[model samples]
Target: MFRDRGPAWRQANAGHVSLGQLKVTSAIESCRRASLGGHVERSEDCVHTQIAYNACRNRHCPKCQGAAAKQWLAEREADLLPVLYFHVVFTLPAGIADIAYQNKAVIYDLVFKASAETLTTIAADPKHLGARIGITSVLHSWGSALTQHPHVHMIVPGGGISPDGTRWVSCRPGFFLPVRVLSRLYRRLLLEKLIATHKAGRPYVFGNQTPLADAQAFAAHLAPLRNAEWVVYAKRPFGGPEAVLAYLSRYTHRVAIANSRLIALDQHGVTFRWKDYRVEGRGRQKIMILATGEFIRRFLIHVLPKGFNRIRHYGLLARGACAGNIARARELLAIKKREDAPTETIADADKPRCPCCGGRMILIELFVRGETPRHSPAAPTRAIRIDTS
Candidate 1:
């Protein structure tokens, strides 16, 4: 689709697209192509050789995230506690989401800070868990249909350490926290910070939101949202630590749409699958067709500001305190070390294999961009076998 419509779409929406988005598009289009250069690998057993091109490695590139997700999940496996984990989502109202589109760096950072503070504040309250909890928050800017629906997905353990850091304070068997309470506090905290940010003239307003540049106009624009009920959804607790890893693997490195979801791209449009959360059962999985230009526009809108870390850890899971906190929690729970855990270290996933013989493919030659390899196989092949491990 990009090969056919990319140039036209960029020309039409030249003013709307950002340089970062353009770079992402260029990188993804050139990924695994001869223009980016690659290496030659020969199979250990069968002498089967192929030219493996370099991936773009853009975080938003769907083709590049599979290996990243695996590596990330492997690291997170150690961070998981034995207790039940909860999946909580903090969503912005339509009003806020629109503003966030223009002032992504400021608004998105506020979303993380506001959501993290809300969780930590509520969990530390005497009425609630009254313990210091850890949080893993991931920002997702798009909904299933590739629409701008900014939200944060939070993974939290069902328990936390006491204020004195003496004992573990666990929630009741099934419940994590009151969604209504979380929603109300989250709404209040975010709006307050947003108002402050606006007053300080930090958030940028553009295009349709140009009027919001004025203080009065922006205040009036946000007035209706103050009374609106923000969404704070908490799904059922995951069965175990392993289940949490399984869930994170899907979401942590997800792009707007995976290649597997593409059904067709032709004169009709770009057809893909999207889940309608409003519907139930089998009816929820529906097909959507969008114009190539519209699809590209939606995808580009989700390109995050450069240097923004979408995945953040707060409280006990924070970088500085994570190790100590995990140890303390385990000790408080009287949990024993796993004797049956895998003893071997994780193997490097970069190694490719031969398609025919299923043996390790060793790198034999390297080439620069637009340069041909010194040695070519008897039967030259561009299709390098991908390792599924």
Candidate 2:
């Protein structure tokens, strides 16, 4: 779809699109093609050969996330505690979402900071959990229907380490934190930061949002949101560490939409399946079609600013403290520790399998960008490549 209409769309929306989005679009269109180059692999038993092109590795590419998610999940496995995990979501109301769309880098970073602060502050209160907690937060910019719905999905352990570091603190079995309390604090902190950021001249407004460039107008725009009920939803506790892992696999590296959800892409437009979350039960799953240009636009809207980290760890799970905290938590829980596994790089991982004989396929040749492979995997059906490394 991008290859067919991308040029026209770019021309039409030239002023609105950013260079980062264009770069991602270009990468996705060229992914797994000869332009990016790849490797040639041959089956050990049969002389079957395959041409496996390199993935773009752009975070926004749907085809690129599977291996990335798998590798990331492997690294996070050891960090999981043998405890219930809570799923909490902090969503920006429409007013803030509009601003976020315009100033993604600034507003999105604020979202991360504000949300993290809210969680830690509330958790540390004596009346609440009263312990230092850890959280893994992933930001999702799009709703199921490809709308710009900015929200943060957080996976928090059901408990935390006591302030003194001498013991572990657990929330009630089914309850993690009060939603109303969380919602209120999150609203205050985020709005305060948003106002501060605007005053610092960090946010940019455009088109329909141009009026917000003025201080008074921006304040007025945000006034109603201050009183509105900010949504802070807490889902039921995950079954166990395994369930947490399963949930992480689904969301950690998700793109705007997966290719599997695409039903058709003819001239009529790009038809894809999207769930209407407002609907109940199975009826929520429905199909919708958009013009090729419109679909491309919506997809590109989620292309984040370059080098922005959408997935962040806070509190005990933070990079610097994770190891020590995890070890201490394990000690407090009286769980037996296992030997640490050696870290494996993508290249050191398992070899791809042969489609013909099911035997392992070994890398035979390497090619640089735009280079052609010497050996062609004649029967495309018999040539296999695993989307891992």
- Leading candidate by lDDT: 2
Lowest-sum lDDT 10-residue window in model 2: 343-352
Model 1: CA > 4 A from native: 338-350, 378-389
TM-score of each: 0.94, 0.94
TM-score for candidate 1, please give it. Answer: 0.94
The CA lDDT at 369 in model 1 is 95
lDDT digits (tens) for residues 1-389 of candidate 1? 77678888889888878999999989888888889889998889987888888888999899999988888887888788888899999998998888888889999999999999999999999898899999999999999999999999999999899999999999889998899999999999998999899888879887888999998898899899888889999999999988898899999999999999999999988999999999999999999999888899888899999999999999999989998999899899998765665555445455666777789988889998989888776475456799999
Model 2: residues with Cα > 4 Å off, grouped in runs: 340-350, 380-389
List lDDT for all candidates, in order: 0.89, 0.92
Q: How many Å off is the CA of 296 in candidate 2?
A: 0.3
> Per-residue lDDT of 297-340 in model 2, one digit per residue for the tens?
89989999888999999999999989999999999999999876
